[model samples]
Target: MTVVHVLLGLGWWLVAPRGAQGVPRPFLSLHPSREVTLGDTVTLRCRVPHPNVPVSIYEEDGEPKWQWDRVEDTAEVSVNVVTRDFAGRYRCQYNMTALSRFLRVSNPVELVVLDPNFPPPVMSLSPGGRVKPGTDVTVSCWSTYGATFLLHKAGISAPIQRQSLSRGNTATFTLYGVTQSDVGTYGCSYHPRGNPFVSSHPRSEVTLELEEGGPSMDHPVSQQPAPRPSLSLHPSEEVALGDNVTFRCHVPRKGVRVIVYKEGDGNYRWQQDGVQDTTEVSMQASTNEISGRYRCRYEILAPTWATDWSDPVEMVVLDASFPPPTLSLSPRGHVETGTNVTICCRSPHGATFVLYKAGTSDPIQRIVTGNTVAFTLHGVTQADTGTYGCSYRPQENPFISSPIGTSMTIPWHRDTFP
Candidate 1:
């Protein structure tokens, strides 16, 4: 016997169990679908395999929230006033006496409720400047209140990414190996932590654009110095052991041969002759020994002229075995402008320490060697007020580094003194 059902605008054909020849699997459907606004009506209907069976609908908790007995094969429970508590997982099950009193349960469905009054989260893009192909970018959603973040791309009905945070008010989504297809407008909506169904308003959109070809300079092509090639790391310059990393070298012209060099080693790490202006080399960082500084140069195939090497880029593989560094800020509470403040990082082992400011990609300052590094801020201003973190690499283990430490915030005042 064949049983066909349609729910939520989609159709499905139900199949019977092998031993129970004519008993089709029980199914559940929702009226008004999974997501609904507050005060909306929703109905949960369960279609059982047998007629005149007892059906019960339950939430995530074991206790049944609703139950009904019907002579037909279907049982339904309706909610006239949908509240935040109604937003959760719901499933239905039925007991059939003909089948040895066995109970069969339907698949669970998620219910989301939107709150029209909640304000939207603010969305921002990382590498806020220019984005080029073969690079990774992060999109952040931040709100004053803690919530679950839903990242949405324009023209897509459902969210592309979802992140729930129990403590923080911010969520970040990273787009790896970005290409031309990644260029689009994105926004974010959030559901407050305790009330998962209460979605906030959508944030303003952020448009992403990729650099098409070679970079442009204001100076004339004839008067300027020979254009140098540029090198970039995809995903990130920093990575974990066993993670795959890609190195991209972009030249001013296509059909050129590119060579990437490793610092301190006379031998070139990789070389490629390609028709496209941008070429990429991918490898897995199996060991911390792979961490090092690198540069790339390009040679015009026809003219046989080699361009100067691009700026050095370092890859740091994080070693979780090392303890995370610690960050501290002086002038305990709030400091007035024009005041000198000290920020310090303490590590278990002496090495290279770096300081990072929140919301920015690159490190603000780095010390070549130290167990405890103190960074002094001269005449601190409003611009210096933000959260800061630190991390360090052991001198003996140059290739591996500790994870980022806890962050400390420094607030600055205009002029509190007379």
Candidate 2:
């Protein structure tokens, strides 16, 4: 009985203390649910109920991994500014003879690190200022302050080019063999030693413009120096009847004078001679007096040189004859319901005729004939009464007709009489 009692006491003490309260299950907790970017830190704690048992703490998938002992009920693990590789699942466990419970994985905390010191680099191409396919081009990446630089391209999973410019903050990425498939958006990143790395916002966007077979400008003039003497004209293209237009000439280079002339008008109408430097000439638009092509000529008068006429540019004066087109009302200018009225279009000389009604933008109808044309208004009504006009297209270079026609208003109440 004494021996049995001693054995029973020892067994009870060992079993009861160990099974009831050897050490509470290990627990892991995090101070912050999320970590700040770049220059921030994260703290992870492992809690053990009893101070007698040993505790080991280390980080996995971060910098280095190790095991530690002697924590005194709690163990703290700290890491600074997590990186892309540091982003993953982490766990802490208490080990005495074997691994203890995992403590619920510490809620899977995530550490976010941002870089505020380094700014994104700027990228640019040279030569034509446009990215062309199958052409050798250079891409330059320049940053304000960064540690490492990387350049990525297509077909390659990793960075195709890299440079370690420890001297300055600028790096250049050269593509030795360029092709059509090489066109794409490129990104760059900068990482310092202790701080987190920052990626630029896709600064380089490459577009491929293929060269088509054509007579391209072989020696195209990117820019031209100011001419010795310059001439300018108002109403460069289109002009209206009775509208006055002006022409001016200026000498950008010294010792040059300008002469103005009106071509194909029998003889030169006006001439300004020996006019040192810059001079101008003007012409009036007349009904029958002025009409044809006009141009200017520059002469090195003081330097004893022959006069050279600049390119010939043409202008036309518009006139559709006087008294306009006479619009005569048929059937005594009044027609009964369901009756037809003849609207004849007449002018002196018009290859094409356009007729319109007052207050309406679109032409009522058009007629193309030698000199005169006509439109028959079937079932004439009160809506047909309004002002009317006719214009003619000339056969000459101007190709625009004169704006002269007739205006007539038919009474709406007259239709009720007949």
Candidate 3:
């Protein structure tokens, strides 16, 4: 009798077949594809060269999940309602009783069961008006989760067209020279690629209506397009890691919906706010992911027209949480009235330094230069006798600022010099 044992490698237990090196392993394949929507049926086929062979399918290192006593050259295993438990790597092995007791193992294939609760793709028809028979028709499908898209007709069991690639969660299907028979409802669904693929559920559908005769010359009058909105960041574009920044989108028109977009967000709108022409959205710079290109556009709900996207603006987040700059006074601590005192702030990196007096909203002086900047206070008086601190913003990123450095107290007194 031959025995099969398990071996551990790379933190995973692998079972190797004890079949002879010259023997060929069984071939494993999926019926529809590697990805299946939840509650959908999927079939796994195991084929061997000879008939009446014993085949068994195993997942990972567990025991056989399916077994076939004496199938033809091919054995089929079906999953009626695919569930979360059916999502994993599967492999098949077949035993040859007459040849040897050892089993021949086949290569593993991954099965991904998509989630049923995820939102489906949106379908839209081009040439919003009636479509003519001899003219080409285009159907577009867009979704937040985009990978592989399938265009399905109402009465078709299989997809009419399949798109292997998509442009940022959007795919377009064209029907050439449509006829009267082409008048039907069409819908689309997509499968997003990941560890476990995601399927678009509750798909959206669109209908195609053909014009009776010659194309109608009575086209709707064109209206002016909406004006583009301007986008600006409060407190500048560059911000500190933990700070918050507000994105302001403004346009000339009023009572319009404003939409914001982040570069890689695909078909999903990043954010929307304000019924008026102007809108403000605040976001925290908690992670590096927040740093990206952003733009905005305004739409008129009554007319149902949107303006072109505005110019893109980049936001940069700086990690400025380090040791504070050093503050030093030229005259040490105490200073006499009618005398000159120089206060210098030094930081590790080249930055702009600002000197602030205690209990004051405004800074005494702000200087933009190298790593160090000095403030000269001539004819110092009683008013200068207060605690002062200095903060610096890196020259490369002016919007980001470091915490206030150590403070120093200056004592004021009457001039007693010769």
- Using lDDT as the measure, which candidate wins? 1
Off by over 4 Å in 1: 1-24, 71-73, 128-131, 155-158, 202-204, 209-418
Candidate 3 whole-model C-alpha lDDT, 0 to 1: 0.63
Q: List the residue pairs that clash in candidate 1.
A: 113-197
Higher-ranked by TM-score: 1 or 3: 1
TM-scores for candidates 1 onward, in order: 0.43, 0.27, 0.36
Q: Considering summed lDDT, which 10 consecutive residues are worst modelled in model 1?
A: 1-10
Model 1 RMSD, rounded to 1 decimal = 23.3
Count: clashes, candidate 2: 4
Candidate 2 lDDT by residue in tens digits, 1-418: 0000001112222222223233355666556643345546767677776564555543322322434556677777776755554433344544443322211122233333435444567666543344443354666667765545666554334454455443676666554223323444555555443232233333344432334431122312112313434456676423456777677666544555455554423254444665666676655665433544445545443322322234444454555442344455565433454356555556565544555554554444454456666655544433333356656554332235565543543333332422
True-vs-predicted CA distance for residue 193, candidate 2, Å: 86
lDDT for 252 in candidate 2 is: 48
| 10 residues in a row with least lDDT, candidate 3 | 1-10
Tens digits of lDDT, candidate 3, 89-165: 67787776654444566767767676766677888887766777656578888877766677777855556656544
Candidate 2 vs candidate 3: the lDDT winner is: 3
Q: Which wins on lDDT, candidate 1 or candidate 2?
A: 1
Tell me the lDDT of model 2 at 43: 70
